[model samples]
Each structure stands twice: as C-alpha cells, then as structure tokens.
Target chain A: MKKWVPTVIFLAVAVVLIVLAIVFLPVSKSVWVWIAALLTLAIFSILYRDNPIYRIAEHIFVGLSLGYGLAMIWHLALWQIALRPLFVEGRFILIIPIAIGLLYFTRLIPKVSWLVRIPISIALGLGSGIAIPLIFQATIFEQTKASLVLPEMFAPGNPWPGIWAIILIIGIVTTLAYFFFSRKEKSVLSPVSKVGIIFIMLGFGATFGLTVMSRVSLLIGRVQFLLREWLGIIAQ
Target chain B: MKRRIPLTLTLVLGIVMMIQFFIPHQFSQDFKNTALEWLRVIGGFAFIIGLASFITHHYTKIKHKKEGWAYSPIALGALVVMAVVGLIGRSPNMNWIPVTVQGQQISVFTYLFSNFFTHMMIPLGATMFSVLAFYIASAAYRSFRAKSLVSILLLVAAFVIMLAIIFYNVLPLGDLGEWLLSVPNMAAKRGILLGASLGGIATSLKIILGIERGYLGGTK
Candidate 1:
C-alpha cells in the first residue's frame, strides 16, 4: 500500500461529507458560517491526531494573522502617520522616522548591518526609559501601597477584614523575604522564606486551575458553536 | 564607530525620556508624545522586518524542497492574497466587481478580506487555544502527585478554586476561593511584582547607563 493512500482516502471522505453536508445540512444564510464551522472542526481535529487538515488550518491562521497585522499597520499607522504626511500633506519631517524604520532592512546587508542597531537602540532606549518610572509607580509603589493597608481595617466589629489585610501584608513580606533571602540563609523560621514557599505554591496552583478552566470554557464555546450554529441542534 | 554611536543614542534617548517624565512643561509633554509616536512607527517597521524573515524561512523551505514543503505554497498564497485584498480591496468605495451575497451588495475584495478575519481567523485562533485543554489535563494528571506539603497545598488550592468556580452559587467554596484570591493570591502577586519591578528598574538603569552593551551584539 502506498503512503499516499491514507491521505487520498481522507480527502475523498472529506469531499463526500462536505458535499452531503451542503445538500442535507440545515444551512445558514451566510457562507462564512459554514466556513468557520468547518475550520473549527479542522482545529478540533488536533485532539485526535495531527493530520493534513489541521496543518492546512494552522498555516492559514498564520498567514491571515500576519496579513491582518500588516494591513492594520499600513492603514492605521504607516498611512495615517507617515505616508500621507510625507506625500499629500508635504510634512517632510515625518521622513526621519520612516528613514529610521527603513534602516531595519539594513539587517539583511551584512556590511551596513550596524545601521540596524540604530533602530534597535532607539527602540530599546524608548522601551527601557518608559518602563522605569512606570514600573516604579505601578508595580512597586502602587502594589506596596495596596498591600500596606486596606479600608477594611476601619470597619467596626469586623476583625476578619482586618485579619485578611494583615495576612495579605504578611504574605507580601514573607514572599519578598523569600525573594531577597539567600538559599544558605533559609532556615525553618529564621529566614522568613519557608512560609513564602507555601503561599507561592498555593498561588501557582490557583493560577493553573484558573488557566485550565479558561481553556475548558473555550472548548465549551466551540462545542456550543458546533451544536448551535453548525448542527442547528441547540438553540441560541 | 558603529558601537559607539548606537550606544550613545541609547544613552541620550533613555536619559532624555526619563527626564521628560519628571517635567510638567508643555514642551516636555509634546516631546514625549512625539517620541512615543515615532517609537510606534519604528515598531511597525520592526514587525514587517520580522515578517520578512518569516516569509524567507518558508521560501527557503520550499526552495530546498524540504520535508512538508508542499504546505508552503498554501501559507504563502494565503498571506499574499489576504494582504493584496486588505490593501486594495477593503475600501468601502471599491465595488468594481459586482458581487451580491445573500441580498447584500458588497465588493468581492472587501467581502473576502472581512470574511478571512471572521471565518478564518477567529475560528482557528479560538479552537487552537481550546485544543490545549486536553494536553494540560494530561500533564496535570501525570505531575500533580501530592507527595509533599507544598504539593498538597497546591492540589488543595487547585481543587478549591476549580470547584468554587464550577459550582459558584451552589457552594460556600465561592467565598473561600474569593478570599484566597484576595488575600493570599494578591499577596503573592504583589510580592513577585515588587521584586520584579525593582530588578527591572535596575536593569533599565543599567541599559540607560550603557553598562549592558549585550544588545550591541559584540564583546567590546
């Protein structure tokens, strides 16, 4: 038997099923619905095994994604900001950034490859500079402020909220200590890091469980589409 | 000459941007805004450059007639077709070809472009992510052994959170899960965030000061 035989049989079956589906399936008015439903099934096919149909869908997704991004850049940014300003509006100053942007292509030319660093440096400088003060304010200062105290502490006859706030603070302190403490310094209780480990584990586990559930929800949504939109077996 | 100029640019730009953040002057704000816009413009070019390499990779595969090379044409074809359609065809006034679909008059190019996103992109994207659900469960089953106190705590937290979400209204576990997230999870998150921000700020400072020239791609 030829290796191509399985592929041939699969294609033949797929074509026949598709034809039958077109004829017998309770059709929606929009052709895109059918296409989307078929693509969804193609993606779900990965659960069974990797095959040509899944590969085709995956490649199409990649191509379309890049194409979409490229078009948006052209339409929104490059066109509105750079091209129009350079051409129609006669704002010659915009050429500076466009020229810098074009320098990225210099990477392909080894001798001028050093020029590519111009853009890289600019990007890196911009990103790093912008990140510093923002990170300091948002992540460090704000988070510290939040964990330091809560309005719950002021609630009369409710020690639970105050306790919760205290626990959160301890959790933060111990966790920070865990981050700061050297491995050699981590004794049972002296280093304050062991308790941090427990909280970290708990946090990780909760995160994983939440991630799994989110995936499950996606699966449910696809299944719901198949049943409701494709098969017309379930109501909207 | 090559390294010095780029390094100097990084230093100047970084320091200037940082200093601009502290200034409340109108000129400072405008300078910051224009610099940000320029950054975005350059970022777009960066993306296109990345895509150029992507296309070149597939081209190389096809040129060499490498394994699974037959699929390269499909990938390239879709990319070119979508891009061509998006560039010239998505215009509202571009109904050169008379195409009516299900009683709506639409340009064939515009229709194709819109349909590619709606039919092709969303379905594949969502389903691709959902496919990971199976693998995650399989991996969890294999690794989630409750051998230690930490592992036990992990499993307990996982089960508690999962169960709480699944039967949120029916069980008291909802309150427990919410409290766990608010108190312990928030603590862990804030702790990690604080540490990371400090480290990140240090790294940024290092880069701004040109102590980290690793991005220049050579040992000087």
Candidate 2:
C-alpha cells in the first residue's frame, strides 16, 4: 500500500500534465509530438523508480534499433554484394564469398562449429593487419612529431608560446615516464613519474568537468522540451 | 585439422593484408576491395546470428516466466513490427501495397518508420542518457573531496574548468582552463595515445602470428 500510494500520486500528476499539454500547447494537434513527449516522460520516469511504462519503452527501443539495423544490413550488404551479383548479374565469382559467409552459421551446429573459425580468422586477421600500420601512423608517429616543438616558438617578444611549449615537453616526458614500468620504484625516474601523475590527474579532472557539462546539457534539453514544447510554460 | 587450418589462414591473410598496405598496384587494391566485400557479407550473417540469439534468449525467458518476462512479448512484438515496416516500406517500387493516405502521396511504411524512430526511439534514447545528469552530480559530490595535495589540485582544476565552461565571459578562469587543456592535458593525452597505439600494434602482431589463440575458442 505504501508503494502504491506514490505510484498512484505519480500517475495522477502525469495525467494532469498531459491534459494541460493538450489543452494549452500549440503542438497538441501533432500526434507525433504528443507521442514523443509522452515517450520522453516515460523514459524519465525511471529516475523516480522502475515501472512497467519505462520497461516497455526501453524494450521497444532495443527491439526497434536491432530490427532497423538488420533490415539495413540485408538491403545494403547481403542483397547488393552477394545475392544480386550472383543471381542477376550472373557473377559466378561471388559464390566463393557467399560460401565462406555461410560458414558463419556453423556455430548453430556443435559438430561443425569449427567451420565458423574460418570466417572469424579471416575477419580478425584482416582487422588486426589493417590496424597496425594505421595506429602507428596516426597515434604514435604523429603525436611524437607534434610534441617536438620548434625553436621558432622561443622567438622574441612572445614568451608565452615558448613557456607553454617547454611545459608541454616536460609533461609529455613525465607522463611517458610514469607509464614506463621497466624500472624499480626507487630509481631516478620515480620523482618524474610522480610529476607525470599530477598532469594525468589534471587531465582527468578536465575530462570529468566536460562530461558533467555534456550530461547537464542533455538534461536541460529534455527540460526545455517539456516546458517550452509540451506545456508552453516558457517562452521560446 | 580444425586448429591448424584456421591458424594458417590467419597467418597468411594477416601478412597479405599488411603487405597490401605498402603496395600501390591495381591488383593489391582489387584484392583489398574483394576482401572488404567479403567481410561486409559475412558481417551481415553475423548480425543475423546475433538477432537470432536475442530472440531466443527473450523467448526462453518468457517461457520460464522470468522476473521481467512480461516485457519480452512487447520486445518481440516491436521487433517484428519494425522489421516488417522497414523491409516493406523501403521497397516503394514493388507497387503491390498502397502507398498513399488521405490524398497525400506518402508511403505508409515510410511514415510509420519515421514516426516510430523519431517519436519513440529518439526520445527514449535521449532521455535515457539525460538521466546520467543526476547520477553524475551525485558522483561528483562524493569524489571531489580535497583529501591531499593531489586531490586538492584535481578538485580545483575541475571547478575551474566547469566554471569556465558555464560562465566564460563572467570569469577569468576560461583562459586558465584553456591553457590547462592545451598544454598539460594535451601532453598527457598524447603520451597515453602513443603508449596505447604501441600496445595495440604488439597485440595485432601477436594475433597475426597466432600467439593469441584465445579467439579460436576452447574447442581444440
């Protein structure tokens, strides 16, 4: 009865809000807008407590996304590349790929599950091979090159750029030293590594601040949707 | 036979793919394209297997009347409805189904798809993420306590960044926050990126050389 009381009160309040939205809001005529507004509220209801309405909306979201993705994959990939070429265009060469792709289904059969490894091997091998050179080129080499600040940064009058460049170089060295686990804790690199940790913490703090801001913005958006779009309580 | 063949395929294909990156020949490009096309088709089949697994899992839960069993039917119903609408609505040239409503030349399937995605999916997804705001606020309160020198520095940095972002013109902390981000933060980020990339390359090489056989499953 205690749980039921809150549930009943919440529902009563929700009904009142919906009634106000329909009667006062300009967008009341658009059925889609009302649906969207209700769905948004239903999702937000999870904050109060898990209920059947929120669960239903959550399940539907997952199912719809999965189904939409499958339909797209069929039309974009399987039909276009494998089926159409093999049947309509009479490209017999596609049969090899189609045959290999069929091996992916061998997982459903215990006796022939080993066949699935072939396709997995091919995919893993290609993906890893592609990643190696690209990762090196993009992250390691480029970042190292960018870190090498030029002497021109120290050119006359503009001391701030030079100071920043020096600080960055020191921060990079210390951060790398911190990650280098090759040496003992009592070694000469220990102090530098400790400095590295400070920079890392500062970086993490900035990241957390930015993340909080982004999440708050999303909350603000939903609030604006409710107040301005649904209830017309706030001016545009 | 099972293990040896797959490992050999990994080794050969991995080397070929790596070498093809350096090669500028037309044959090499064609080989890469064919490999990509094969990967796409195989990926589609993999997605089907995943979908089958999802449906089977839900069906089993419903059969056993599990804790959240009541929601399974809604999920299954939504999947079927969306799949039917998306597949049928995409093919407007089929000319079998009526594609007009109330004198407006609109595909009903397309309209349903757009409505479901916009009204149902987008709102739900966006609101779901928005719930994180309250949780993040609570977490920040618990974590931002100044216990030591390092913790104090971290808390100060966070406060500065947050204030700068929210009221850049009102406060002079924006330039300080920007400086912190561009210099020290960027340096640390670059260092981490370099280390991770090196680690990734090592793992990729290990996989290619068949040292990482965990991906082959525990069958053999």
In Å, residue A140's CA in model 2 sits off its true spot by 1.6
Predicted structure 2: clash tally: 0
lDDT of 2 by residue, A1-236 (tens): 77568767888999987777667666445678778888888888888888877898899888898878877888889888999889999999988777878898899999999999998898888888778877877888888888887888887888788888888889888988999999997999999999998988888888788888888888899888877776667887
**Local error of candidate 2 at residue A206 (angstroms):** 0.8
* Top lDDT hit: 1
What pairs collide in candidate 2? none
Residue A83 local lDDT, model 1: 87
The per-residue C-alpha lDDT of model 1 at residue B22 equals 93
lDDT of 1 by residue, A1-236 (tens): 97667667776887797777668876566678889988998887677577888899989888888888888888777887888788989999889999999999998998788899899999999888888988977778878777766675858877787888888888888888788755565366555788888788888888888988999999999999877787676776
Worst 10 residues of 2 chain A by lDDT: A21-30
Task: Give the DockQ (2 decimals) of all models.
Answer: 0.77, 0.71
Error of 1 at B175 (Å): 0.8
lDDT of 1 at B9: 90
lDDT per residue (tens digit) for residues B135-204 in model 1: 9999989989999998998888888888989988865899988877788887888888888888999999
Off by over 4 Å in 1: A1-25, A150-154, A181-191, B90-106
**CAPRI-style quality class for the chain A–B interface of candidate 2:** medium
